[model samples]
Target: MDWVFLSELAINGALTGLLYSLFAIGLVLIYKASSVPNLAQGGLTMVGAYVVLALSHDAGLPLWLAIPLAAVIMFGLGFGIERVALRRLAGRPVIMILMLTLGLDIFLRGTTLAIWGGTSRSIELGVSYEPLFLGDLFISRIHLVGAGVAVALFVAFMLFFRTRTGIKLRAIADDYMASWSVGISVEHGVGLSWALASVVAVATGVIWGEIQGVDQALSLLLLKGLTVAVLGGLDSILGAIVAGIILGVIENVGAEFLDPLVGGGSRELIVAAVLILTVMIRPHGLFGRHDIERV
Candidate 1:
């Protein structure tokens, strides 16, 4: 076994995992704020990418301008979903909430289809795809940039949680009834979470769009995000980061070694296996807090 090849795979996988974490963090944010694992995150990501594509490519706006605008637009869309739809189901059953998100996912996908159609479109985010060689190993410039962006945004969000609004959001997450008693608006807090999630989705979509083009298949990233969210604990941001890297490395290395033996498609299999194992062994995830309910 060549160690150089293994090292290369590991490095690339780690970078890919950071990207996955970026997407999965959106799910964590939603779950943390509302106890809802947003099933429509993938659709938001796909539509957000197309929105950026439209603004930059079709509308002739510069890439920088288009991205921020797309983020704002997606933010509003998310807020609307929570306020108009999710708000109506405030005390609904778990199954109903899940189904609502699933329905939202379908609605988002349909909207994308109606506007952008089903064809894939290449998007230019002004990131060069040139490979940077480090002695015997090489890495894509875009991947490095994307990973850096992910880390930076993650840090920024962590800091945001220190502000007044962030504190309110955190309080609401801790106990909705308690928060309301203290005059903290649970509705606004939850809506803000959805908006932020959509903003994060835009960033995830743009980075991925640059790598794979804007297409319907980009929505498949929802599964990757879901896998990471579950493995990391739906409400734990740090867990998402760690789980993403673990999954990323496993995907690259496992696929390389096991694909030939399994006749291919081991990448997805590895993800599924890890997810299953995490659910079975540690239902709350590596860093998730296990709830202790009073009878």
Candidate 2:
């Protein structure tokens, strides 16, 4: 009944949605460039968080130094994956490529578990965990910083797409042979995309780990990100951003008011139901492009 309470929830949902946006954007970037569904995004994200954790906690590196180091490592990891696993498999069946990525994801998850074990560890991000109070409204600094960082990253991506190299990448995505004929290196473009996506994953992981700590279960969030990607469309960057925010708001609002009526856990159901309905109604998603081929 209180409007202020409702407003608070809305703000919270929107900011949290920005975090989801970061995840979804990483996905969209890969899908758009490679036409390969990268199931390894979550693993890449988890690696980023753990890298920071080790550097800051075990090795005693400052947060400032750890961030860029993590980013570079992640980028190299991504580029290597593309160069080694994906490059040889190009022009293969789409289903096979999908399977390869799924396999890669599983391998990464298993390797991560073997190396790090199942124990969860908290990392220091220098942000206070104490909740802020404002005349009956409560906010967390994590939400504010996460949202700001996400938006800043999104802006950076937008600007990157305006550059000359960005245009070439887009062109390659449109038609590979044409771009190749025009002197664009398909391998380089795809490799760069994977690298960029990995960087985004690292950033998202760091933000999320700061908020919720490092754990193996974090990779499960890839499912939620996939849902957001489906709602936004597989190839739509802008759609991913919008759909992430929408998902956050819907999930939060439903959880706040509808959970009691349903005996809880409606958040997952809401997202799943939206995905199902979207598939039945608009399979390509809100901003997805439809392709028509004439015989």
Candidate 3:
């Protein structure tokens, strides 16, 4: 445990956390609006990454163009899911809804596998860059770019929520019937939220693919995103952001400092432990509202 090593670990953790936030925030948005976690979130992220790889790497489209195209496709996918899948199950039991999303996750995974053939791919942004050297620590240009993009997106989303449509979405999240009475289309709001969530998923996919190669296993990586969302408080978008950063930092630091002593792969165990403790101690989550059951 050198102090310098600890400092580097902390920095790495923060970067990882920001990336986690990008994924988790989308989960929170969908959960807040629809009151059901989209289990397909992970698969959606994988699809986005594969779309980018296919368009940019295989098809020779520029990264800039391919990224946005993947986002648009994901947006359509989200809208389609809402219209064709989720809409049919509205007002269903929570368990039933969860199962529906699980089924969706399987479907999306199969679709990706069929199209992508389970091969790993990587993207080259083609930008020549150098690391930012800070005495004994070095931060890669790519991580810095990823963190900046994540923060910018987070701020932009906050601002968007201040608009009228954002207000309506929040209202729908609070009470669909009340929003409907006020002329807000609940279905539209749900569709919008899903679309927004899909965009976020695309952003996360791009960043993750840059950090690690695009692969079929990208969805499995979303277990981290799911953990961040649950720990942060499923309904709180800001909480997801904050918690994602915290989890990222903790995981990085733990893996760097504690791995030698405790053994590798324990970092994931730590995340799972934290999630369990947080859920048991605060069922609603760190920033989640407490549910009040009324008879």
Candidate 4:
């Protein structure tokens, strides 16, 4: 084990971690505001990536314009999903809502496959930037930019949580009836949450697509995002971010160090093991609140 190899591995892990954090945060936002585990988040991310690719490659739009347009489309899709699929399920059983989201996930996957035709596409953002070389480690300019974007979004979310709208959303999450009594429109809050989640999804999609090209299989890759959310605590934004970073680091480290010993594909096994351990230790997740039943 060369020291230089270890250092490079660490840098790679950090980059991957930041990307995971971006994806996980969206899941946390949706869960926190709506109390529904949105299994369709990954599908939306795939759609965003494809939208950017189509706009940039097929329509000849610049990456800058295409990215924002993709986000806007995803926002509309999120709002529509909430309005059409989730709104009617208000006050319904949790299982029912979960199943509805599952259905929505299938629909989104089918829609993406139909539109994109199962082909993979790449985004050439023309970001001709060099890597920062640090002795034995190298970090790409694009990854640094992506990490900066993730950090900025995370900070922005933290700041937004202090605003009046954020307070109303939190109130609804805490007690929907109480929030409604205080004149907060629960439906509107949930819709806003979905919209915000969609924006996050788009951002994540763009970043990840830059790392790994956009493909119809992108929706299936959401299992990684789901794992992050579950391990971090479904309702904790900070927890989700932290958990995502940790998961990314672990996956990279496992692949780098243990893949030879485990005969390849050990990273996924490591993730599953970590998830199982976390669930056993803290079923509510790292930041989730434990429920207490009254007699």
Candidate 5:
């Protein structure tokens, strides 16, 4: 009933959701293009963040330069991952693809652990840790910056999908065989999707590291993004966007109002319940299109 408190929670949660959308959008891109559930998304994100850390910290590069460097590295990583491990497995059973991605996730995580150690390290983006206040409502500067970057990138993506390259991407997403049949170069399109997805993952990783620092736990964001993807719809970018915002708001509200009553941890409990509820009520998700395959 307290308007100020409610408004604060809503805005902060929505900001968090905006960050979540970065990775979820990447997941949808992969699924749309390759029909593969990329379990390695979190691993890619973690690797991207570490690249940033290494460049900015160890190499003494500026944050600005390091971020783009991370993007480049992630793109190469994604493309090569597909080329070496995924390209040959195209059209394989879904379970096989899923297991491969799971293995990739493990491989990437192990590599990160070997390089970064187990300790959590600050991202040191050289940005002010100041909070922006609107009367009684306040938010962190990092969150605002991240939300702004996310919105700009999201708008750019909207435009990207309208270009010729995007058309090819969409064609591949809609139908792999049909795309190849039309000489669209399915392998090229899928490889591009992986590259682009990793770029997005890098952005998400940098923003997330700024907010939560860099650590092994960052890989767990894949689960959070996956939850957003599932709640929104595996193949729907808009669904991921909407679902991320909804889940973020619900999490903050539940934590504030229900945590005390439950003695603690009600926020996660509520989110897990929402996932189950969404599965029960709308198996295809709120905006997921139902596919009718007559087999």
Candidate 6:
């Protein structure tokens, strides 16, 4: 058992987990505000990445300029989805909303393919992908920076939600009918949640785009992000962070040890296993509140 090798895996896994947390936060915000798990998050993320790619690579805009511009575009897209497609179905069954999000996902994927032509392209962030050596252990620079940025954004959002507008959104999440009865604008809260989710999607897309090329395959991140969200709690932002770290570490360590026995590719399987176990053991997740209603 080489301690250095083990340490490297754990550290890298933690950093990667932060990235996973970023992916889950958008889903959390949407679910918290609207009780929708946002099945189209992956599509939103993939499309956001392509938008950035188009802006930077195709339009010759600088990467810094392109990222914020893409975020604005995605924000509008998310708000549009909520206002146009989701608003009318506000009081419908949860299953209906899920189906609609799935439809939106398919639509987004098709639109991206038609526009981007299914080509895998990279976004040059100008960040070194070189591994940083710390004694006998090594860490990826990209992962480190990505994780830092994620944490900062998460903290900012947490603070933002503490404001009056944020309180209105939280109130709506707590009791939609009650909030509406009290004159809180549920539509605006849900729309803002979707818009913020889209903005978050852009960040997730850019980081993941740098890690993996920007393409339709980027949508597959939905599974990984979903696993993290389920484990953390659909409505728990803090839980997302905690669950992401645990998932990252466990997946990395498990893959390192179990891959040898299973031939390989166990990392992907770990997510499914964790999600199943979480559902079986703690359906509301570690930090999620248990909803109780007396009929």
Highest TM-score against the true fold, candidate: 6
Candidate 3 lDDT by residue in tens digits, 1-295: 7888788878878888878888887887888787888787888888888888888878989888999998998899888888998787766677887898788778888988888787777767653457788899977677777778778887887788789988788787788778878898888888888888888888888888877877777787667888888888888878877887889788888777678987788888878877888878877778887777899
Say which prediction, candidate 4 or candidate 5, comes out ahead on TM-score: 5
Off by over 4 Å in 4: 128-130, 292-295
Cα error of candidate 6 at position 100, Å: 0.6
**Range of the 10 consecutive residues with the lowest summed lDDT in candidate 3:** 122-131
Question: lDDT tens string, model 1, 197-216?
Answer: 99999999999998998888
lDDT of 4 at 234: 85
Rank the candidate models, highest lDDT first: 6, 1, 5, 2, 3, 4
- Which ten contiguous residues of candidate 1 have the minimum total lDDT? 86-95
lDDT of 2 by residue, 126-221 (tens): 889888787787878888888888788778877787799877777766777788788988888888999999899888888898877788877877
What digit string (tens of lDDT, one per residue) describes model 6 on residues 1-295? 7888998999999899989999999899899888889999999999999999889989999998999999999989888988899888887888999999999999999999998888889988989977899998899998998888778878977898899988888888788899989999888889999999999999999999999989999998899899999999888888888898999999998999999999999999999999999999999998887897879
Clashes of each: 0, 0, 0, 0, 0, 0
Candidate 6 lDDT: 0.90
**What C-alpha lDDT do the candidate models reach, one value each?**
0.88, 0.83, 0.82, 0.80, 0.85, 0.90
Error at 257, model 1, angstroms: 0.6
Task: Show model 5 residue runs off by greater than 4 Å.
Answer: 292-295
Error of 4 at 75 (Å): 1.5
- Give the C-alpha miss distance for residue 100 in model 4, angstroms: 1.3
Query: Scored by Cα lDDT, where does model 2 land?
Result: 0.83
Q: What is the lDDT of residue 78 in candidate 4?
A: 80
Q: Is candidate 2 or candidate 5 better by lDDT?
A: 5
Screening candidate 6 with a backbone cut-off below 3 angstroms (N, C-alpha, C), the clashing residue pairs are none
Model 3 residue 258 distance off true place after TM-score fit, in angstroms:
2.8
lDDT of 1: 0.88
lDDT of each residue in 1-295, candidate 4, tens digit only: 8878776777777777777778878887888787878888888788788888888888999888988898888888788877887788876777898898788778878988898787677777665567788775887777777777777888888888889998788777777778778898888888888899989888888877877788766676567777778887888777777787788778887788788887899888877887788879888888776676889
The list of candidate 2 runs beyond 4 A from truth reads 133-136, 292-295
C-alpha lDDT of residue 242 in model 6: 87
CA lDDT, candidate 2, residue 200: 90
